[model samples]
Target chain A: MITLSNLISRIPGGIAQGIIWGIMALGIYITFRVLKESDLTVDGSFATGGAAAVMMITSGISPWIAVICSFLIGILVGCVTGLIHTKMKIPAILSGILVQFGLYSVNLHIMGMVANVSCNPSKNNVFITMRSIPKAILVGIIFAAVLIAIMYWYFGTEQGCAIRATGNNERMAKAQGINVNNMKVIGFALGNGLVALAGALMAQYQGFSDVNMGRGAIVIGLAAIIIGEVLSEIIFPKGCQFFTRLIFVIIGGIVYYLIMIVVLWLRVDSNDLKLATAVIVMLSLAIPNLKKGE
Target chain B: MLRIENIKKTFNPRTINEKIALNGVDLVLNDGEFVTVIGSNGAGKSTLLNAIAGVWLVDEGKIFIDDVDVTKLPEDKRAKYIGRVFQDPMMGTAADMWIEENLALAHRRGLKRSLRQGISNSERETFKLLLKEFDLGLEDRLSTKVGLLSGGQRQALTLIMATLQRPKLLLLDEHTAALDPKTAAKVLDVTEKIVRKSQLTTFMVTHNMKDAIIHGDRLLMLNNGKIILDIKGEEKKKLTVESLLEKFEQASGEEFSNDAAILG
Candidate 1:
């Protein structure tokens, strides 16, 4: 059933999916690389974004407005996680997990208590749709480019640098009169906002949203980031510009999806996709440490 | 410039590892007065500095920095009036940031961070001039990540950063203890230069007896969470290691036993 030409035809779809997930990985990069906190909120917020966007689109709201709403909602979710950690003194990891656990019900409520929602692309002119691969890829590229530009500019500002410092060294940040708690809260918000935006785009592309759409999303995001970082190191051993790194993260996402396409072409069971991803990520993460040992 | 009234802190209170780090300690400092603290391992010299820096809330006491009660202020809030360098050089600056970026962070200490460029062109020039004065060659490496710098260089940079905003009080917690003697002396020289230039109120804790005797306008000896001895002015000026050791033994009613304090 699997053939080289068949695999080749599926490549564009994989690339489109990769770009969407790449945006999600950018969100993860904020907390994982910048704040140095692993937030599990993306798993839930991602689905929430899809749910919100699909519900809005079906309710006659424009796709752009729907995507923006999803981003704001994700930020609100992140703020809850942040406040729970900073104010309630819960550990960062636990706070993110708690909010994520609670978001399941919230996402269902947003989807009118349904487990899944869909927008008929035939009637609605979605910003991105898989019906036309070229259009979908073009829209994804534009979104990625604009988001990357904003991130590059924002992280160069005074407040942005403070956030970076907070992640780098909390004690030093506080010593420099930075409100580290506030910076962490801001990081979580911005990170999840981007994650939700990616979710909205994915929903539009797929024409449907499901409650479980974001299962294992964090691992996938990490895979993209790790792949991107490793590749970037190989391509630019001395390190590259921040803007270039951002672009590489998107490329990493595409590469990950392309690998999945290859695995599919090899006739691996679809249910084993998650297993393969875990192995790939584990190996990607281990390669650097292994090389260092040698 | 600084006042402490009956400040106390107990680590792991009521637990098997309970330690009274500070107990009913009180002190006052005039503006521009530099104070050096000396103590044995458990004498709470660093704890006293931490109390003033508001690293944690005191158990029962009021602290006044320039006559403003700040006993309840959190660490970051207190940072507006305080500058600190830790024993670890890495603690004072973000390692991943560029040399100039770290300076920019320090330059904006106690000021509201806005959407403005983190480091302006004029600010970069000012930083370059300042770094040039230190002669660390860091002036030429403004864009280099601070992690690439040597420990001594990092400490020197930290010293400059602490004084960048002209903090009301400077706290140096064994800042040079981890460096080699050569580097330690270099950092100490930088410290003295900055303190004398700005006349900033300063508190320095050191294990080296000679350093304690050589620096500061006044000296404090902490023993078992208490200030057992306080010497200043002409008395501090005339103090030698031998005489200071005798004074410590007399006040604490115990033999001076910390090897590093004696040998360092």
Candidate 2:
């Protein structure tokens, strides 16, 4: 049951899924690292994206347009969270949770009150699907590369630097005439937009979208980011370029998925994957603190 | 030029921890006037500066910078006309960003941020020339993170950032208070140089009496949410720590026995 070939065959699937999740991790990086806010809206926006994409694809819409729509929808969701946090004077974490909670009902509505929606590849002309794993991997890599390049260029812009400064130090940003609240709203919108894009890709790749597909997505994204940071430290002891950092985030996702494949191959209970993810995240987070202790 | 009229701010109104930070305070700063503010712990020196900076809305008052009322504007909006260097060097600049990037942000103050490159070659050259004036070897380390810089260097950089755009008004809130004596003097020296060079209207709050007297053209002493003494011109030049303490005691009707603490 635990044959090497069985595990080997799953590697491509693992890589494909990892790359999609890697895109999601990039979203998390914007909020968690750049904006310094742990936005929980991604968990729900992910499902919202999948559900929207599946429903559109099933109804004869172009899959590409469907994905783009999902991205825009995700941005609306993030704007709601941002407004709630800033204008309403609520805590950032609570605001994200509120949006995520509300998104469940909205996601269900998008899927026509159904828990799952599917677009059969045989009928629907989906752009990326599990039917051709190799093609999916190739497209995923291209998407990652293009996205990374855009991010590198965008973050080096004047408005982008303002967002970074807002995250780095709010008082300084404000004193420098940079609007801190507007920057935060923009950050949240951009972050969740990427998450929804990733969710749409995952939906198409698997040929189905489930309302619960985004459950525990934040932990996975965090896991990828932390793992990537560790790898970057090891490879470039001093520092690495921003582009390489982005690439390693995808590599980190790949490594995380490969490890999961091995765990599944070893006959670990499939239902225990969430527990495994928690362990991985907790260990990754604790390692730096433990090192500091020594 | 800056104007304040009957601005009053009270913290924790109706609560036991209530504090009357500023009470009906009014003052006008002329163009290129360098004013130093001094007080005890709760004399509302910072509260007054924050009011001018629009940190929070005053309960009752008006603030104007260059004849434009800014009492209703928030901190960021008012920042277009004002440059502030906080007591903590860390509060004035982003630590994770590079030295040049910090200067770039300061240079673009009051301007719209667009899709253009954050730091242009010409802007970088200007930043280098500015940093070189600090004589802290920061010009060569333009790419280095501000966090790695010493306290004095960071404070000096903050001063440069505050004056980069020649703001209508400059607010320095105990900016050099956290540095050592030599470093504090150095930063103050630089501050004097910049203010004089640009003729920028400036307000500096300091706990050290000597710095207050030595650096600015005018000095105001606050006590019990009021400006009890305003000394300037030849009289300010003739004042000393001992005489200033006497003035504080005469104005507030209280003994300032711990003059040494105030001198610091």
Candidate 3:
């Protein structure tokens, strides 16, 4: 118990979890921070990604191909979110919740089971594939670095600036020849695509895809964003430049689990994990607004 | 260079709040022409610019730029031809990004955005030279976040961003209305210098009658949703606030009631 090797092993798991959820954090960052769209579909779309990856891999697809499929599925899910917002004329937040509720069952069907999809049978249903925890951590880090680099480059372009413009001042962005509608659609697609890729990697690493995995993801991502925002405000308060937003979000994700690790170290039970997470996010969100008021 | 024919827009269409913003308005701007629009509140001055910018679909109209029927084009697709500055200084550039980065973005308008680490050395030098023209000491501070600049500096930077591409049509929708009068005048001066130096076709909307008359070769007055008066040539040169008001009543058959527009 609490040996150096055991701590190292758990470090890999915690970091892997942080990186996988970084995708969701990036998704929340786009909706809440960037485009200012509150997308609750994040939870549903994230599970859908895992289910899609599992379904594809189970159907004789290569592991890498399943990853691609997972990303595309995420894009489709995002498009549905947009369709609900635009064509159906539904409120954005409501549309997200509706889609999430639908995906709860759909994810079960994708796994060809009502509970979980596993690479091997176990009583507790924990599966261990060749994608070991250490390898998963490496994959997560490399994937995050590449994705953030691409994000940095993309947001530096005109279209990227246009997307940001939509959030800063929608009317002005439209008047300056930026289509806010199309930009929102693109932003959603990109945001969820990252989330799905994370899910694919997660399913492979854990050797199982379960429906409940995505639960409370949005809150975690929001907490990370709020924490990241607070950090960036204190560290680089002038602004979180294009690349810096993504960088800080990644750091936010890492710091989030480190806080979780500390909570677990304090012997907090599993039942209160969600409660602790909620409090942390609430505090992060509140402190900034309170400071502004003061 | 720009033509708007029979354009009409209704806000909250098919509802109780359906307010007609532009009622079959028509206007033409020759190449390299500088035109100013002045109107009362709800006069559709901004609506006309918005229609051309493709912010939304017009209920009825044809918009042409350099003889191209641009009404069917999307906003970003039309970015190649149009440059716009807005009343809010934040509208024109990404505030968190550096001044050079914003300029680099403006410079790459209508081009494919690639992953090749934006802003080559040559472009950086070019941006510096362009920034120098603003004389706002921005050339030395290209690394500064745009949000740190004063409103006037931001507006000035915004003007440069709009004109950097030598756009076929430049639209200014009360670009300086949000600033103090002194800063507004400074920004207006920067606007004038840029517009003239580039020799681009430009349409500027302003609430101040004096600014409208003093800045452009032509001034058009709007009331309700129609153009009440169009002055150009020798007649436009002779306009004063009083005489312009007299013409508004003559053309529109009503007294101008926009106190802010009149007093401004």
Candidate 4:
């Protein structure tokens, strides 16, 4: 029988995981919603960030510096995808796929040809750890809050407005003298950079990084975004500001994890978790269309 | 202030569907001139505007705006001097953006975009006043999305956007073609007021012969990628739909085949 103690013990861990995924969701929001471009590169870039962070920390680098480097490396990865899409004239989805495939090898190289790496929280000055779940949750929340503030400020700037316009209407953006191609590249770089930042934090929190850790990251990010949007519609019936919408995206991530905890608590087979995630995402996406029909 | 020299463009080159859109077309417009363009289907009117706007590089020849060679510039780079409204009302403004945001974007045309705030208090005031002048009650809806506006309102807003920064040349490619007759007429009225008030060098392509003659200081008829008739001044003012049809027949040695042009 599932007990109250079992549920209580899982809550902190769930909150930490949700906050980390919430950061990833914000990254996906930039590409999927703001740029209106499908980018699958996050799956590979997430692992790359984890590998970079773990390897750097193991090599005696500061954890904060290692995380920052992981973010920069992610931006470079995103730039490769952007160039493939914009300069090489490949479709956005195909370009992201190509980069994702290439980054699997690059990520392995970053981990010194290893598929996984682990850092001891005591040996390394790690940023966060599952040993202290409450501390990890607090750290994740702070990181998310800071990132959201930066993003809110960036999107209100002139350059950010240009990027928004490029996504909304390419023809109108070009007519307005906004370089649409450049905007796409900048967006990709920013999106992947944030995804990498989240990956770094996840690795530090879990005290391990693995190549397969980010296999279905894009789905999780989408789940967060869609859930956040749906919830925001209910919570703010009249309307809300852009910053509020972003905050909801983070909340969506938290809610996703809470649901996952509940499902696990129900004694569902752990091996079938991926299938459960897929069903949840599919339903979340279809609900809006289905509601419109009614 | 605008010149097109022997520009040529072909669609689906080397394929069975290959069609030459602009064939060695040449034209020039002095500063402050208002030129209306009329042509039948496949007459290269839209192609001419696209070439001048640098939608793509011309296969041959050069384009100049205000004596600056812009034939090699990409569309966004060429936007420094060119303002355009497309055949579709939806093509002009970002639908999801607020009305004031759209105006702010237009206000920054050809100017450098930085980390500065996208819209300032002063600029918002200016946009509010400009929307008030439209008399479409859009002034109160500055924060509303452009997608929620009516077709006529969108076109009028587009006209205002094209002239927000006083472009060196304005290219209107049947901007009101998609609107209903009444809405189209209202948009045309706004177009004329903006063009006349700014004396913007304009090239307007229209399917309506009456509109072609009723507005603008000069009118040109394009046929088979060539300018077959050019009328201006008192001659253009006195010209009617019948006389324009007669001129097309006289110049091209073919019947004026576009019923929309004649009936409109």
RMSD of each: 1.2, 1.3, 3.6, 1.3
lDDT of 4 by residue, B144-206 (tens): 999999988998998899899999999999998899999999899889888988889999999
| Cα-based lDDT at residue A269, candidate 2 | 96
Docking class of 2: high
Residue pairs with colliding backbones in model 1 are none
Q: Residue B146's C-alpha lDDT in candidate 2?
A: 96
DockQ of model 2 vs. true complex: 0.90
Residue pairs clashing, model 3? none
Instruction: Give the residue spans of candidate 4 off by over 4 A.
Output: A290-294
- lDDT ranking, best first: 1, 4, 2, 3
Residue A37, model 1, lDDT = 96
Expressed as tens digits, the lDDT of each residue in A1-294 for candidate 2 is: 789999899999999999999999998899998999999999999999999999999999999999999999988888898899989999899999999999999999999999988878999979899889999999999989988998899889999999999999999999999999999998999999999999999999999999999999999999999889999999899988778988988888888888889989999998999998999899988988999996
Which whole-number lDDT from 0 to 100 does residue A64 have in model 1?
97
The residue-level lDDT of candidate 2 at B143 comes to 94
> lDDT per residue, candidate 2, B6-85, as tens digits?
99999999999999999889899999999999988788899999989988999998998889999999999998999999
lDDT of 2: 0.91
CA lDDT, candidate 4, residue A146: 93
Q: Model 1 chain B — which ten-residue stretch has the worst lDDT?
A: B249-258
Q: Estimate each model's TM-score.
A: 0.98, 0.98, 0.87, 0.98
Q: Name the weakest run of 10 consecutive residues (lDDT summed) in model 1 chain A.
A: A116-125
